[model samples]
Target: MGAGMRAARHYTLALFDALAAAGYDAPERVPRLPIVNPPLWELGHVAWFGEWFVLREASGSHPGEALGNSLLARGDDWFDSNTVPHRARWTLDLPAPGALKTYCREVQDRMLDRLAREQDLDDALYPYRLALAHEDMHGEASLYTLQTLGAAPPAALAPIGQDLLPAAVTPAQSGDGTDAAAGDIAFDGGVFLLGGDQARGFVFDNERRAAPCRVAPFAIAADLVSNADYLEFMRCGGYQNARYWSEAGRAWLMGQERSAPRYWRRDGDGGGWHELRFGRRSALDPAEPVRHVSLHEAEAYCSWAGRRLPLETEWEYAAAAGRPEFRWGRLWEWSASPFLPYEGFGADRYREYSQPWFGTRQVLRGASFATPARLRSPRFRNFFTPGRDDIFSGFRTCAP
Candidate 1:
């Protein structure tokens, strides 16, 4: 098999094996979450997506065509994400875990066979590459879903080689401050190139066609906001005070009845802090960057500190400018900008990926601990609804 096919198969099997080992095979054991998909359905969807793009669509078959000949007869009906409503997925009669695993294997075998027959591996194989990337994304999603469900960390997801284990919090070095090094790194900021350059292989649809934009002189935080920093906001009643929050933010807070960051629990006297990760609870580490906060919570914290979230352009400029002091990739940092299309924006072969969520979502720059290393790039854009706090997300601030 080719390198891309091998990688796609490896990640797909790893995720499925992990889910099965964790007792996610039974439908009753899988917890229901508004933001998460059923594990069984998700597994089949990953395989279906790969087959759709690589085997069917790449072969010039139109959308929803040739379904009867699919590796799994009902694959399209069960896993076409575009047609399958999120809520309706839980109601579907999904195949058993064992049968789903077989379907995944059959799809992988056929994809590999097709890949070997193809001559062009470069630009001609774009759809195959897209399939691999799609599977890798869902692989990360599966892990986070397990986290959201409060399941134990899967053995397949255990860190390899140099990667640190999730449970092991590294001790802060001497002279290392609990908060991000205090200061604003100032930039003269003229016209800077923004968005992805196609020259850079495998640019996502949202990041296509680099364009130059004039940016005003600005300053951004040297490091992400740490748990210690946000703790002060909570103690000062940041959540209760409406002044710190936007109109939508206030509504979300009241609807959810949230007082502190998600997964956080305070001691009876309000002096101690702890956070739940996976299925285990541990004392909150003050020096660690805060995770699992919504855009609203990040904005409120910035208001309380008299700082503001950085514009998406500024975040891009800082990362691409090669400032080693500006630490990111530890968490997905929220920006002040709303998600929108760049100049001359056009959808790629995968139309559903970026065009639909253009205006309603908030833009986030940088990657998180759970993000695949290959997917982490300075130009990559990740967006989510402002109210989403289930994923690993945090924020930094800019001078007002």
Candidate 2:
């Protein structure tokens, strides 16, 4: 098989292995969450999506192609994400774990056969690349799903061929140390080139059509907000005070009955905070960037601190400038800008990907630890609703 085909197959297998290692084989043990998918269904869908995109859609097959032409007889009915309603997935009679694994292997083998016949791995094989990128995205989703389920860390995720660092420090080891000092980076605003370059290979639809945006002079935080910094906000009743939160945020906070960040618990005497990761509770690392926070929470914290969230334009500029001190990629940082289309936005083959969530979601720049290495790009735009705190998300401050 060609290199691209080989890499795609490798990542697909790795993701499947990771799922099994994370107890996906034991469906009864996994909890049902609205934000999460049933492991069996998720795996089947990945395989089906790859086949649909590369083998059927790319090849000019009929839109209403029969599933029997592929390996699985009822694959479309079970795994087509567009056709399958989110809530109806739990009610469907999905194939057994073993059957799904077989289907995955079968679909992958067929995809490889087609890829081997192709001479070009670039533009000629865009569908294969898209399929690979899609799978990589799902791999990150699996990791976060494990986190949301409070399951143990998967063996596939352990850092390999790297020197081991010391265990994460507990709150007792560092008692509310002052927020890590950060500099305000000032930019003389001007017209800046924004969005992805399509000629550069495999740009997402949302990031297409590079355009120039004029931004005003603005100053932004050099570093992400640390756990220590957020602790003060919580202690000062940031959640209780209505003035700090937006109207929508206030409603969400009350609906969820939340006072602190998700997965955080206070010690009995209120001297320290603990965070739950992969079903294990450990003391909060004061210096680590605070994560798993919603846009609302980040905004409220910024409000209390007399700072503001950076606009998407400022963020792209900072990243493009490549200033050494402006560290990112530790967590997906939230932007104040709502997720919207660029100038002359056009949908690619994957219509549902970017168009569906345009105005309703908030944009997040930078990648998180759980994000796949291949998907890590400064130009890549990730979006989520303001109320979502389950993902690996955080934010930095900008001058108000």
Candidate 3:
């Protein structure tokens, strides 16, 4: 428990440093989202979440009158999700940015200081532990915010060599003699357990109730498809082909004239294709997992590859496959299914988590390099509609 808290504290500090280095300390520099928290507002909200759930809840201590009910009362609105209207957060007049920072410091200091004495690691520390994870999610968003504005990603990430990280996927070793051929993870679909079995460990509110369900035997990719993989589809006039895409996906592609990736400039190069990332031009990483593609784009790529997107259940089965710490950090994976409430789903302490996103968005699994491990799990579901590509999301095809 102490170790977890320590990690959380370091992460919290990293978040602040990233923001400051990205120029968000000015508050005015934090971009205002039409329906999302400003980077500064988000920072404070994450801190407030820790206080409300851990520090104050444990000691029965009040965080002063001014900071009184924020963690409890306005917790959801401030830190709840992307669905909320952004213009309204500024209206909340949230503790004048500086006060938010103080609130953050106060909460962190108290939580870390008290973690040593906390005995109810299972119950008492659960909420704050969860809160710590929550903040990590927002930190990733803060990184994306920097990228979208053509500003710069955090300086911590600035030094990463322009050359791609070595490819983690080895298709030649994947029961096939070819690295370019697709791969699969055949799930012996049956009475598969859905959601987190809370008794095992800490899980988010939405993952509380686990249940048994059946799924057909299916095959999923052994690893996420790489940049080289997706480009093959584009090279074959895949985007121009209507049959490979869903109606909505085809329309979206048509609008963008996006036969290629959002950052690519095609083969204008010295013997290889070039792409843009962190606002700089560099050779595309053929071996690295493809990123920044939309669910629609993912779906289209899968179709062109003679495969289908896995159902959410299929994605989860593969993600949870081998129980290998439940992660593939190279890129986010898109599922064939849409986000929805579980069979017996209902609200909990933080009511807005997944209940609100049902019916409107597609499900994404696994985490990208930007995703914090603490905030991810086989049961932690992420959603975005197929049309959006402003964040990190990519996918692999399942066998026919």
C-alpha local distance difference test of each model: 0.77, 0.77, 0.65
Backbone clashes, candidate 3: 2
In TM-score terms, which candidate is top?
Answer: 1
Q: For each candidate, give its TM-score against the true structure.
A: 0.89, 0.88, 0.80
Quote the RMSD, in angstroms, for model 3: 5.6
Question: Per-residue lDDT for 1-400 in model 1, tens only?
Answer: 2676677667766766666677776555666677888788888888888788777754322454533446776777788877788877877888888798888888888888888788764565777778877887787677677678766655655541122212222221111221233566777676767776667357787886677777777788988898999998998999999999999999999998999899898876878989887767767889888888999999999989999999998888777666656677777889999999998888887788888899999999887776666677777788999998887789999888
What clash pairs does model 2 have?
Answer: none
| 97-177: candidate 2 lDDT, tens digit per residue | 778878887778888888878766466577777878887777667767877877665465554112112112111111111
| Candidate 1 TM-score versus the reference | 0.89
Residues 1-400, candidate 3, lDDT per residue (tens digit)? 5566666556555656665665665546656654234666677667766766665552322233223455435654564334346565554545555566666767777777877676765776676667767767766776566556554564656653232222232111012111233355555566557787667457765564677666777766677778888878887988888999899997898887887777667665445578666566777778877777888888888777778887877666655544332236556678888887776776654555667778998888767777655555656788887776767777877777
- Give the range where candidate 3 is weakest over 10 consecutive residues by summed lDDT: 170-179
Better of 2 and 3 by lDDT: 2
Q: Is 1 or 3 the stronger prediction by TM-score?
A: 1
lDDT score for residue 228 of model 2: 92
Off by over 4 Å in 1: 58-62, 65-68, 159-181, 268-270
